[model samples]
Target chain A: MNKRTVLWTAIVLALLALLVLGCVFFGLFEKSVVAKDVDQPLSPEQMKTLAVRGAYVAVAADCYACHTAKGGAPWAGGLPFTTPFGTIYATNISPDKEHGIGNWTRAEFHRAVRDGVGKGDTHLYPAMPYASYRLMTAEDVDAVYAYLMSRPPMKVANKPNDLNFPFNIRRVLTFWNLVNLPADMPPLDAARLEIWNRGRYVVDALGHCGECHTPRNIMQGMKASEYLKGAVLEGVVAPDITKDGLARMGFDPVLLPAFMKSGISAQGAMTNQMFEVVHFSTQYMTGEDLAALSAYLFDLDKLPDKPASPTQPKPVAVAPELATAARGNYLALCSGCHGIEGQGIPHVVVPLSTNASLRLASARNLIHTVLNGIPGQHFPGLERMQPMPGFKDQLDDRQVADLANWLRAEWGGETPSAKAEDVAAIRRDE
Target chain B: MTIALKKLSLTVNGKAVDPVDVPDTMMMQDFLYEYLNLTGARMGCGQGICHACTVIVENDDGTLAEMRTCITGAHWFEGRKVRTIEGHAKRDASGAITQLSPVQQAFIEHFSFQCGYCTPGFVTGATVLLDELKRQPVARADLERAISEALDKHICRCTGYVRYYEAVRDVILNTPGLIKA
Candidate 1:
């Protein structure tokens, strides 16, 4: 062979070897850093205490429902959650030294659980529910950590999250944390009773009930101003638990605890997602806790009444066909629950005549409820009152749109029209 | 396949039974139904999400605690004692098991069940909660929480949650020194 050919081949081999060595070195260095930052060993006694605490925390956190792979080990996480953006998988949290957080230090664990930061400073997607966990006390976090470490180790590697380009950029979460996240505990109201304060802490902090119950801004960050004023999540409408007489099922503060504990209100029983929350979390809370949650929730200032007249009531002359059909449908189906005069069953059904929530808000709830009937309880004493039934199977998307538009126009006075497209979107939710 | 089983002796409902060998993976609910014929704990969601299969596990201390039988394996009860709802009603001086526990009475009085499916779990759970709170009195608000938390595992679809709350509240209020009526 020629000397030139041999020299060129030798150079190529050396370059390839150098590249392979560099890749291996980089991988080892990354893992070592992560291990050094995250892993911390626990004593056996601490493990036992943590196990007990973990059980309670697991219940409190409702972690199993989200983390456990369908029919998998309790905390050996692999649950897939789908969102509008993409699907996210819950990582293995079991005490598996190799696959899970078995190697994570207490501080690293705390950061991941509370602050949503991972080892090597990887940003966890907000889907981790750290926004609510941020409210957890240090001790609570420790107890949960203890429980996780105490569990029998399961070797389950976590699946990668499937978020789109911009969202997959984990570094952007650093900014998301700064602007949207409230990393600190809520300031305690000194004037409130200890029990009431505890309730506030649990609800606002540990329970993070508002994360689901409260409305959100355009960026999906919770709207603090409209906290617990009800929001639509996944597909379920978390009703306004606030004591806006018209918005809530006319539930007074006194009755709110009963509602929380039992998932029933004066007007109707809770169904769907709210039912599960109550069954798992609120129902397990101490009565004082329930009362405190109710007390704090009831005290929020009622939403300011909208002016009777809109400054610019955009006149979308309702299409001739839609107007007639919507009016006819409302009279036939709604008047039974909501009286012909639009004054609903007092305290039993929300009055439509002057209902601010029905009039001014987004038509997502109206469309969804009309399409999918509300599942409710029939507790012993109140067997007669069943929850609202879904009309999805019965009504076309356009019909639901027309009915919702009619309710808003007639009751709320002047609001943006609910297009057929809105109904279609809500129907596709599940 | 000849399965190897472990012999375990434990008191159930205050009655001592002969030790029996059973598979480790068998659920507590199946064990209770097959061996003891104590079928009060109904299986609703086999998954731990619903508490229909709750039974009171008598701790080493005198206190009783609730655990779901469906999800928990029978092997966990190797040396543990348990009290089902069937065991809750006691025999009075008359030598007949005529007296229902306060929780049971309260449930009956308040009409807590509609389909009567989740009642046993609620009853068993409430009994344990009441027993724990007996030593230290709970406030009215605390009573509600105690009851709700106790019965939190159980799911009832019929007769909205109000009646169940009322049933537990009645038991707490009626029990003197626990909570003021």
Candidate 2:
């Protein structure tokens, strides 16, 4: 070939090599700096405001529930998290220079908090919840960092995370990040109402309720199509708070903020992990924030439908023994609040006929709730809420079993009888 | 590998426990089951749904409340007093359980428990209910409602929840001045 043609071919190949190299570097971007640097020293007044704002943002995000170990110093970490993979302990987020994030620059901290990338370019496991945090605004991230930095740093080293096989490899998270998290926040809907926007920010960004409430795909990423429809969490049913689900449960949307804040309303009391979430997180939230959350959940009523399972299961047949026991119990003990026809008294008691928990396959929650009896007022309006009493003293295990089975059968729609042994097991286990 | 420790001191089942170092992550269930060897508070649903892990806590105002041991930390009970099922019986000089508490006796009479794992929590909860009822006696007409309200929160997969109410009612009816005349 002529000399000119040969040189042109070489140039084209060289350009191609540069392009491939650029893509590879971008793919491994976690190794390089990503956060924008903030080098200015703020005045005391500015620091105070920033710190205070950060505290609010932290509460909005419910950081303490995951970051702080029970009875441990706030943000000192060591909260044991059990995942399908293995146990991964939360890290110390206090401002200790040696053991915590004391030395982290704003840029570095931002990336870690927003992108799930830790110091030294390490990919943080999803347990840190950067996936949801990624939706946060830059200002919100900054305020949270400032608040966290203001905390007294206790020298607590993070326990090494115990994960199995390829999960232990931090690099695998890069792919998961690519599939689940977007690098930039979705464009704002300028036309949306202010409260709707605020609610969206809290539900989709700060609160990260979807992490547990939203059903997961095979890869453990959220199934966005079925957003807020409902999912199982830690062997307990996290009921669908979606507009339709809430409507089905007869939950008053207008009263939701109160319910979120206090764990009680005219409907019923919160139980299981919800009880814990209300106790640990929502209890500390501002009324406005809770209102925003309720707003978002209420607005979800108009979302487009997707292929999804029924929010609850259909009922099965009941055992004669359970039905007989339930009949007697219903007349004597339960009828006061629940009513003889299983029609619950309005504003005072939740109806068993349409309740969500009764239709579930496992009787553990039913047994657990019956044995424990509802106690404590996480919110103010709980005084107006109806009370459920424990029968552990007066009822035999067999009778309790029959009652649960009967409730499921009659009101719950043809449901299977709860075995006495199962009740006995739950009673024994918890 | 060493984690920070905290000092915990509390009265358990009427016995004062000296201050001891406990890991902050140590749950109340672990404290009762492992440290103090008070196994009555069984861990059912570690997340606080099942009241099987419940223990009776006395407030400063002399009111009693029930708490879940599985989710609560041992340190949360520091400087507080609590009672478990193991404490529900009067002991002789030889440390033998001589006489069962009224709640326990009623539970026995009603056959309230099956596996008995959740019995301690129930017993504590019922004991608290009885105390509250004693402080403010309810009208005879309100007796069923009050008893249902007190016991509905405690779960029993056995006995269909009827007998427990019957037993508590029996106690109230038999005990003079428990219900308004």
Candidate 3:
């Protein structure tokens, strides 16, 4: 231990302390707009009223979709959400004191919903969609808190997340929040109608539609650039719902709201996660709320009811490859249910000619659906679609690709050519 | 325009139905019941969902597969060998029924059907399963699953499905070369 050695050690230690302090100081500059106000004690009547309002708010928020596992107890929360990092199980938000948020104060709940900060100041992962929920008003948070607390508690324990190292650390999420979570939603455009503004709030804030619909950046945060242009989630492409995207799909604004209410219409039937969306959330929305949602989603600047051009479709050119074997395949396996010309039997099969999935440029959804056929679905009314059995084992990848290509050309009209590799890829993902 | 007619020929129940001009739009079920008078495959759902209208079509590769007749056009089965419920049993020159096929006998023994509307379809399905197993036998442990997969598509709406499944299982178990060596 010479004087020079001791001097070097002191200098290194001082620099390391400075670096540590600087990192902590920088984290404080994350510009958090955390809501600290808990709801004041309410009268019994006020609490009841708030809880009732909160019930609708909870549906608008669609908490049930993520929280409830298939056939699992409602609000008990054991649904597993898979991500590139790992799988994260949704937490129990029921009134169970031991397992859920029963003991959580209103202030703590507000922070969790609005600020992405949980009990004990631990940062919640973005899977909670608190970034989108950040737009919710303080009163909305308190109302949700009231509603959740009123639910019957279950003793079901929360499943531990299966994230890899570094992601498993809660401290890492604080930094993730610093980079990802915005301070607040942008100010409402003054030019938009009041109804449109209301709709935007329902979609972006309360509904948190962007969480699944928007594309994610390298950090896996929702990209601010691609707001609602659509992205693939849970093996199915969550189709674009942007105004232009909706228009491209021939969405009548008037009909979309009705579709949202019923989850089935001539345009399309909600399946996959969208089915869960309607079952747990959107179906319960009021007519006015749905109208606003449609207005915002469609971004109708002009009159919504623009009639289409009355023109007949020109015949699509079919390739010899598609015409011979693929056409035979369709007639043998598919034509029985879906008519000879893909003009699906009414109340039996959906028309492939006008199917929204076939119209998409990407063959992912169409290929996936063909490989993994839809289950029997019943809407709010007498309308029911029969279960289409999967043809994964019956049809080879080339056959699936050729069939898709032929169908797209004849019915969907010049969509991308689906390849055998795409079918193979989708098969692997599933 | 006049009703278009097309020449059609196919082997049905070991008898080659000659190239008779039947309407191209006619479904196999309609052709079978109206023209041939075989009348075994009954129309149930018309939507092809109810396998009551199923017929066994022999593939070019000699493999057998069940196909719905209610929705498929008659031309789809043209130039192919098809077997209906009537073809399964043995008969004498006088057309008197002599011996029932193993599937039919098993169904009778298990009481697998009541209304018998779906019996043809179930028999067709089980027959295909038997043919498939003969070609490539499954392990005895997987026989139940094979039977279930083979016959589950046919809706009986009677006899709670356990009897049909039991009957299929009994046929597979009793028969040789069905269980893997």
Best by lDDT: 3
Q: Which residue pairs show backbone clashes in model 3?
A: none
Count backbone overlaps in model 3.
0
TM-score of chain B of 3: 0.96
CAPRI-style class, candidate 3: acceptable
lDDT of 1 by residue, A204-248 (tens): 766777888888887777888998888878776676666573233
- Rank list by lDDT: 3, 2, 1
DockQ, every prediction: 0.01, 0.02, 0.40
**Alpha carbon lDDT at B83, candidate 2:** 85
Best-to-worst order by DockQ is: 3, 2, 1
Candidate 3, superposed: residue stretches over 4 Å from native: A1-31, A39-45, A301-316, A324-326, B1-28, B31-37, B57-64, B72-81, B92-96, B129-149, B176-181
For candidate 3, what is the recovered fraction of reference interface contacts?
A: 0.31
Q: Model 2 off-target regions past 4 Å?
A: A1-45, A300-322, A329-430, B1-181
lDDT of 2 by residue, A1-430 (tens): 9999999999999999877655543555343223444445445676678898888888878888878898888898999999889999988899999989988877778778788777777788888878888888878887888898899998889889999998998767876776777556667667776667788888888988888878888888888898887787765557677877675555555667777887764346677667767777787788777777776787842222232333333555665665655665554455545654555765456666666566554566677777766654334444333457676754678888888877776655535657778777667753
Q: Please state the CAPRI-style docking class of candidate 2.
A: incorrect
Say which prediction, candidate 2 or candidate 3, comes out ahead on TM-score: 3
Of 1 and 3, the candidate ranking higher by DockQ: 3
